[model samples]
Target chain A: MREAIILPTLSDTMETGRLVQWLKQVGDSVKKGDVLAEVETDKAVMDVEAFHDGYLAGPLSQADSDIPVGTVIGYISDSPEQAHEDQGSIPEKTTVAKGMPVGKTTTKELNQRDTSPVATAKQAVPDTDTSVPVSSQQSGIKASPYARGLARELGIELHQVSTASDGIIHAPQVLSAALAGPVPNLDAGPAYRYKLFTTMHKAVANNMIATLSTPTFRVSARLSFTPLKDLAHEQQQSVTLLLARACALCVQKHPHFNAVYTPRAMAMREQVDVGIAVDIPGGLVTPVLRDAARRPLDELNDDWRILRDKVKRNRLGPDDYQGATFYLSNLGVFEQVTHFDAIVPPGAAAILSLGAEQDGKVEFTLSCDHRVVFGADAARFLATLSQLLDNPKDSLCDAAKDQ
Target chain B: MVEQVYYWQALNRALDIELAADESVIVLGEDVGLFGGSYRVTDGLYAKYGEWRLRDTPISEGSFTGLAVGAAMVGLRPVVELMTINFALLALDPIINMAAKVPFMSGGQFPMPLVVRMPGGVAKQLAAQHSQRLEQTLMNVPGLRIAVPATPQDAYWQLRQAIRSDEPIIILEHELLYFSKGPLEVGLEAPPMHRAQVRREGTDLSIVTYSGMLDVSLRAAEQLTEKGIEAEVIDLRSLRPIDWDTCSASLEKTHRLLVVEEDSRFAGAGAEIAAGLTERCFFNLDAAPQRVAALELPIPFNASLEAASIPRIADIIAAAEKLCSP
Candidate 1:
């Protein structure tokens, strides 16, 4: 049997993944678990593994094209002849480069199995033929691929559909709107451009929206960074690394500060795994430093260096960025930024934001999940962290010696 | 209106109630009389019922089960408690061939009114032999009805119903759910003996499960709800005569089906349900039916491996999400 190689969801935040490159081409015999292609999700570029042993077949989705997760990009068959037979069934013209103008290929032109909106939307992108007006041919409504497919099948204008949730219309919403008589022309009077969200940006937007729903309060502290700066210079460690170390030490003293608040229970983590926010090209990523308080400063620096390289290369695994009890976002490297509060990720109880040093003092803003940490607990944690940063040499060297 | 009780206590209460209500009711199994059975399901029953009714048998499942069948034939309602479902294999011939067929073979002269109670499923590191789930095997038998009760309430009523039924029935219990507590209505009519119950109602998908898998499915449903997917959970109280009506009704509304079972995937109970539902509710389905079952391998002794081997909350959630996905 010929197995369709649907693009698997690489991450929770990934709705669609851009095919970066194909590792195996047509006529290539591939084994299960072999890297078939590299897909760039919002979080990272991941290798899509072959789930079956067969010769790779085409009418494959083009490289550098964004394919919705779960859409069939290609196939793998028992033999090259079988692969050719399968490819013959798939419309060759439907396999167009993403972002290029899609010609007029309706339901008849699509593969019977790939008749989803994701596949339809890829087919619906207007070609560069000037005869058809872009406005009439393309109603750029922010809707899911499945919704778009259903709208096309029903001959319902996407722009006229009313969504109950965020402006993005999903299939269920589209179905409901279609059921409730004729949809009103909601797209009139406004000439707004439909902006496509990158997977990473969408994740960040979703997280920020979710964080707003949580009961949170920010506590800012101005700490004298002269001691930490001097200690960092003497120890040849980065100030951000030193601050993370201090935060880790503070978490050890007050375990509640290193806790996650779910509706079920408050999980107090014994290990002070601190996630340090690193600014990547597209968005921010927090690579975790496991057992940060216990590890020596030099060892922590070594780990940080490796993680920084991985982040730069877009090779950080899920483990590298997930399960941080506490988060640290230091904007101290940028000279102009004075102080800014950081959004605490969903699972973590608190995030520590460090501002640029001015007059030998750095502003530290602690945003906590009020459900897990009370004002007093955050205050106590910040106070301990401040104290630790005030005398970094004595505390860090003493902790290292004790370890 | 109702009081909470542990799963084992509910079984004990049902046995106590049935023994007091009927003179012919008797309990027989290894350690059932003296030590109160392996998981203490028959705890304190020996003292109240005395040695005649609450008689303990030696370590011979086939002989004891055969004796229970014989007792049932001669106008006694015998409830035979096996230490675990793993040991029930020793008496499969008696259970399937004799106890299940005696009524039909004898031309309705004798009805096998017997209830075989046994705990099954992986608990801690019971290893391969001890952690077997043979509900699928027992369910395949023609005359034997299978009941897997997940909660204290179901355990209480279903056991009584099984004991009352003239047909031979197997009560498959989870050893891990022995201590879990739920409400048991004191004076209410027992639920139907051959129907499934919708534990949690939703519209996005139906998670059909029973036994300990019901808990896992409910937890998975809760997790799915957090992601905007409402999953209806169906607990198959009766496994043999599957309540296809309840399942089909839920599938008609949800249009998606995910069968979860702790038994191994191939030809397991979930496969049977999936196959049956696919046949009946083919037009109602929006997606192909998916199943989350224990991997097709022996349950390992290691804690982590054992945990990995069985269908878990995360596995159910993943399977349901895939089934619901467009």
Candidate 2:
């Protein structure tokens, strides 16, 4: 018995994933919970796990190939013989038996059935089962015209396609049914294939395009982060975490920078949820540190560490990155980067960008939505942020003094 | 201003208004006059109009129904109430052959301005014979116009429209909906009988239904919404002179149609609707037209079996999910 391993949805927004590489080759033993392959979704590259113990089956989707969510990329079988027999077999339309090959029907049988297209064509018409060949009509097969057309084009028999209710074969049902069968080697010829945007990529693209529509302005200033860097090192914290804490403290004093500007009105949020921009393999993601101004420095550091780990693992839930009143993008860690401004992420009024430290000073750029914070307000917020960073011993530890 | 009323009260109010306005209108059926109708749809009509106008006849659907057709042959507008639509089989000869055909056979010289009000649907364990839905049987007749109202507003306005029209009409009401409450806009003009209302708008698929199935379909639509599939629900208020335009417009957008009905699957209302939609919108349809109808068996007397026989909310959701699944 062989089972088709489908590409599962990793995220709420993920529609399709690119099979980056297969961890196991055909005839390899697979155990439950073992990572079978690496799939690149919209947000990040994730592992495709084997849900059942079986041997890896061949005719797998080629690496670097994109498949829709819920598509069977490959098959897993109980034994090597079954795995080999299941290789290149089309997936069943209905739910397949666990660890069992969909059916014993081979691609050769489908080809033989496909040669008689006229017999299947007669079955496509409504209320005329007699028009079909006596044997085919006796079987009482039901399939949509589009499904029949695709089955004929693919040289697959309509009977091989599984249906859920009413036994009517649809085009998608036919396509998936065909996938379980011998997959054509189309990737061999095309050196360069178009990769469809993952859901996260599409969302980022759309957000960036929408951000371009907002009336935004940038203000740059040099900050002496020597004290903050020392304090962060003493606290066993990264400079980005300290910067986020400083922004949270600064946002409490300068509420305008923590407000979101919409077409209707500017909303000033009560909590200073600062979003820390982190670069992953494919793109950038901002995992939010909620209520940074209210939480203790130690707790904030712990949360930031956990968030980073989650982003690396692509396990950030909706709450992990959503709802940020302010954003922080620090490119200071990168040796080549000096100073760069980031487009304000949606829902945030402003984003603070920090460049690499040159000497005892680092250039900070604040991009503000002009509707929410004017040039003067942005300057004041940046100045407050600079003051907090310059004296982290007072601001960073002040919140914990009350405790 | 909108006023909330029970489904039967709306029909009662429509009857009260029509009986007060017209002197030539008469009400006749078993338990209709003295009993204020088995469902109380004609509750106060008998007291207000008296025995002359509201005449209670024997339990003979065939004889009383034929008498209404004879009354319509002259100038009187007769409103015949059948206690349940299941018993309408006894009156089918007069309804289909005479009342429905009189105006056409008379070459428009005489118009059969008759309204047959009956409640049809599965209610508890009403047994096989009593709980049958026979609107599909009447829909097959060409000369008659059918109006099946799912809401109180439709019940109020559609019944009034049926009484006013100079043609024979059958207003099918759900047995369960008689007591269900909904807002009825008092003075609002009735929508055209041929246009089906899009009760809920969605982009994925259209769940075309009427009568009690409208409520069932709406519940199914809610479940579909939770599954991230937005299903558009079209309530076919008028079954005969079937609302093709509204159905086609919805199908043009959704490209998938799931006709749901409480009738049996074979030669049922949904089958006709599904076939009709396929014929009109073959190129627009992305998938084959599907129907969620009652199982092809007598509605059982057992509560669980009866519930299983008819199209339930889960069955409708399953059908919609399959149609929109890709």
Model 1, first chain, TM-score of 0.59
Best by DockQ: 2
Give the Å shift of residue A145 in candidate 1. Answer: 20
lDDT of 1 by residue, B92-189 (tens): 98899999899989998998999999999988898999999978888888988888899999899999998888999999899999999999896888
lDDT of each prediction vs. the true structure?
Answer: 0.83, 0.83
TM-score of each: 0.50, 0.59
Q: In every candidate, what fraction of the native interface contacts is reproduced?
A: 0.00, 0.11
Clashing pairs in 1: none
* Model 2, span B1-326: residue lDDT tens: 99899999999999899999999888999988888998888898888999989999999999999999999889999999999998999999999999989889889999999999898889989999999998889999999999999999999999889988999999998899999999999898889975799999999999899999998899889988999999999999999988899999998788789999999889988888999999998756768889899988888999999999999999998888888775
* CAPRI class assigned to model 2: incorrect
